[model samples]
Target: MAPIINGRLLFNQLPNGLPVPGKTTVYDASETIDLETAPLNGGILVKILVLSADIYIISRMRDSSVEGRSSPFLLNQPIDNYGVGLVLRSEHSSFKQGDHIYGMLPFQQYIVMPPATAERFTVLSNDAGIPWSAYVGVCGMPGQTAHHGWREFSKAKVGETVFVTSGAGPVGATVIQMAKAEGLKVIASAGSDEKVAFIKSLGADVAFNYKTEDTREILAREGPIDVYWDGVGGEALEAAIDAASVGARFIECGMISVFTGEPYHVKISFNIVTKELKISGFIVTSLHQAHLSHFYETFPKLVKEGKIKYKEDVTQGLERAGHAIVDVITGRNKGKSVILVGEE
Candidate 1:
């Protein structure tokens, strides 16, 4: 059943000892959305079409107030992330009725969003000409992360050997593609042999199963990688550190391997003091301005030319969001996991 407009409130809770649960209520939105106070000028009402469930969301369950970074997933609020939606109502100057857009939206049935919210929501262009889910993957956060992190942080050179963990994931896949495009020799690692094959298909020079082959053994053969794109941290990070080249650059993106439970501690074989390597952790939110500009400036063109490809593991309905999120977090689903919120 479709949610009753302005009469429903969805809340997500991750209590101390309980598993995460999403609760829905037929409540008034007048209190939550401030409907009476919402600006009448150029606002949009969107029904989500597809939503992304990334592993980083787990960190939001940690200490809420840390380093002045407030998490979006509060104790009892509905979680929100990048989602593609269809415009149901438009009172805004920029958007017309029935426009398709992608942006940060709550995990619910409907969102009456303001025009400012639409600023981040791009009108899906035809040049890319792919599935709407691509907006949540390559043309979205993951792809942008790979481009920006490599260009700005790593400054990866042409001949550099770039190592990427979780290479079968949307972000890591793009990292491998971009690295290969830049003429960098790419080495990738994943959890399974199947993922290793997929990584190799994406042009990774060498792909390994971290579960069986041992990352250390693989790195020993391809020692001295110049840039380590640390997407799956913990023990993988430890291994990458040992294999890094002198003055290597490590861009810490996601730590999926250690996102849940107690963090893993792996003693490094190399002396950072002697190796002179640099490791920097980056949150996509911090580089918002740059990412937004890059999204508009580059993505459409790449898509038009068929230069960029995105893969999505789509689940059919909104009711399945929780399972999809779990699948994404646990790496059970290959590629990006999205909840298909609307029919074509």
Candidate 2:
């Protein structure tokens, strides 16, 4: 098979002289990716294998400043985010040729980076006996988001009751199992019936179809949630606020529901004050430095022992990345949506 280049690059301005719709464009780079021509001054070159499409990218696409966080993707350049890749050539001794690793990579056929720049992602191997993609899913940033959201902030205790929004997504699925592991009764909500059933398979005590079932009614029936792990905000958040226990802890991770170019109408501030809920917003990047080691040490065991399971809707080839990104954000993806950039 011939090598194919299908990555997309984003720019700030369109050809018509207006600002780029959302800092995006698609171009072919097959001939432009010769390793001989790639910069080799003092860094490693990685060939991405599996790249993830995340909901947060949707937030970036809409040109909104999400909680004052700057766009990770820059204008007039390829975007960058988490990707699993192999070091094809390296100036650094530690990252020699053929080392499988995962971390943020520019959206191109290959990306050069100083080994010292980003934190090194632990290499995956058959010896570890888990799919490499798990590093970017249940055992990766999304996993840590669920873990820290429930454990550190929510302070969810054994036998307590917890509710998580976006129950079918990557982070949501992990949160359900992790909550169960800690002996918490978990209830989760998703937009589709299939998602509701999938979350139930993941051991959620109660799973509801938020699309058809009224979140307020469901919460009223489920009731007195000790913790509200919110990955989707808006009306669901309002319902969570209304049903929270007296001292409920509301963990705000990512708000996927309202990220599109629409005015936010759901208001839960009054409920927050009256119910005296403890709400905290968190970014996964903030904990990357502090908790990186913990994720590496624990993720493998969870996969090997079957304590955790992951689902992925894989879209082959890099050209599919654009649609895949939109799918994940719109909840069209059943689990984590990944673009397979290369073969195993």
Candidate 3:
């Protein structure tokens, strides 16, 4: 039997802050995957197509898993997040060869799992008229996060003022457009001048480079925001708190500001009390599961009708996965960070 060659990025050590070059090592697995072997009953084999590189994955790489944080990445193993793939073989009734799917897959070229494990993945619809990469980006976790954050947490009403941080990135871009589609006035912040223009192009009523301009000044000029869809936490969060309306809603999403072990102190606890604000933090996975039906029913249609737009920044080649992950964490990618591991 011929040995199946698999290349993967192995977690080398706990990142002290940002992932250093040597923190992860790329290597071909010693154990060869046997393609000729039949899968166990209720199991499937898949060839990974696209992989997601996200900041949340970085938070999990620290030595001790924060008490309330997601499961930490196992040391000396392939870093697992999500990916889009095609079924190569299956022993499960629900899945078969050539079926397109997306789910929490490891950063590897291929995977094999049991039925219970397969339940985490969803088979894609061919009629969706969207690209396979969309399943891992806009139509996938980031889209769901944007929708759920606004619908459930922000509960933003039409004609209200809304603010978003990291507005050029995937989740933030979606939030900006969604807020506009819902008739809310949007003020967004990004790290660079180009990102600011990109956010504005996405229909943000006002967009500014938070790195250059003061977030507080921007919000004050676009004052009394009713909802703050926070992506970059730290000073952005503080500015949101300061600029919040009396009964504003704060939808806490990513905290890229502190992803690298930096400290963030929101010196405005008094405002939370005095302003009678509603602040909520969420994990997109739980929200996605809770609202899977609605998301599948509506989000795709929106994408099809041109009501929703998404962008993907794809880095080609499996060998570049380590650099891709670093780029995403450090805000080097322009849109949703994705790695093309295989042909679509």
Candidate 4:
């Protein structure tokens, strides 16, 4: 039972725009624990291996008074999200040492899940030889967001056009691949030329750098987009609406562009009446019971077989987690942003 360093990132303050590492988060790695003797008290002690940093995390770092999609990050506490870890010691009957699990984990080098709380975690079996990082990206929450959104909301038919914003991101990348597999023409957008190139490599028929180009102009030229897989909202949504075909489907996953209180004046317009478009947003957790079984069974196989290639933006160490959050929110991350806390 030797002493082990326990490093964690705590939410320090809410940001007006993109958050700064030291200012927005307090990196506290001064704590130490004895892995063998630390009291679990009928719980499980885990060594966190991979920590997910998604754009949705920014949505949670607001004032507690303002109700939001997820719970607000409590100031001076660890930011909780999806993570993969290995059980080092367990007093719980269902869990034991050597088991790898994934759940809504705190951003720390180690964690102790109380008996009741440990019930929420799912033990994983990675026989497919997929990277542990994929569990936080293609095989975890972001993957579920895409898997469920496509099956549940997207009503795109074969030969139709499917448009995706943030096409280089985890959810958007998955949707683009899914649409391509289903015999649809894909038009996708990303904030940078590099991302647009990456999206095009994923079989998108048309990929554009949205920062320099006009969404309305491109959609007007190449659209009548049958299914709009939306990650960037505000003006992007307005453009999608303008380019949508009759009875088009809008799978609203994220609103990264407007989350930081940015001013956006784009009206939704009158197309909702004339076109009969179906715009739907979902929290992936809500759709889990209906779809998780199938998603876990099939999606991992697709990822392992290279049918769904995941683009990962991995930042090493718990120390850099705050900057990782910035990368995701500011669209600097090339794909699914993640903080690699440790090796599997």
Best by lDDT: 4
Candidate 1 per-residue lDDT over residues 32-83, each given as its tens digit: 3443344446788776778887776665555465543536466455567788
Model 4 clashing residue pairs (backbone): none
lDDT score of residue 194 within candidate 2: 89
lDDT of 3 by residue, 1-344 (tens): 67578777777788777776555545456656777684566789888999888878877786655665677777888888878988988998989899998889888887887889997789988476878888877888888888887888877788999998888888899999989988999999887887787898889999988778888888888888999998878888898899999999999998887875468886877999989999999988768666877888888878888788877788886678788788888888888888888884
Candidate 1: Cα lDDT at 93: 73
Candidate 3 matches the true fold with a TM-score of 0.95
lDDT of each model, Cα atoms only? 0.74, 0.75, 0.83, 0.90
Measured against the true structure, the TM-scores of the candidates, in listed sequence, are 0.86, 0.88, 0.95, 0.97
**Could you tell me which 10 consecutive residues in candidate 1 have the lowest summed lDDT?**
23-32
TM-score of 4: 0.97
In terms of lDDT, which candidate is stronger, 2 or 3? 3
Q: What would the per-residue lDDT of candidate 2 be over residues 144-185, giving only the tens digit for each residue?
A: 787666656878789989999888898989889888998999
Q: What lDDT does candidate 4 reach at residue 40?
A: 97
Model 3 clash count equals: 0
For model 1, name the residue pairs that clash: 42-91, 42-92, 49-341
Report residue 271 deviation for candidate 1 (angstroms): 2.4
Candidate 1 regions off by >4 Å?
A: 1-11, 15-42, 62-70, 115-120, 268-270
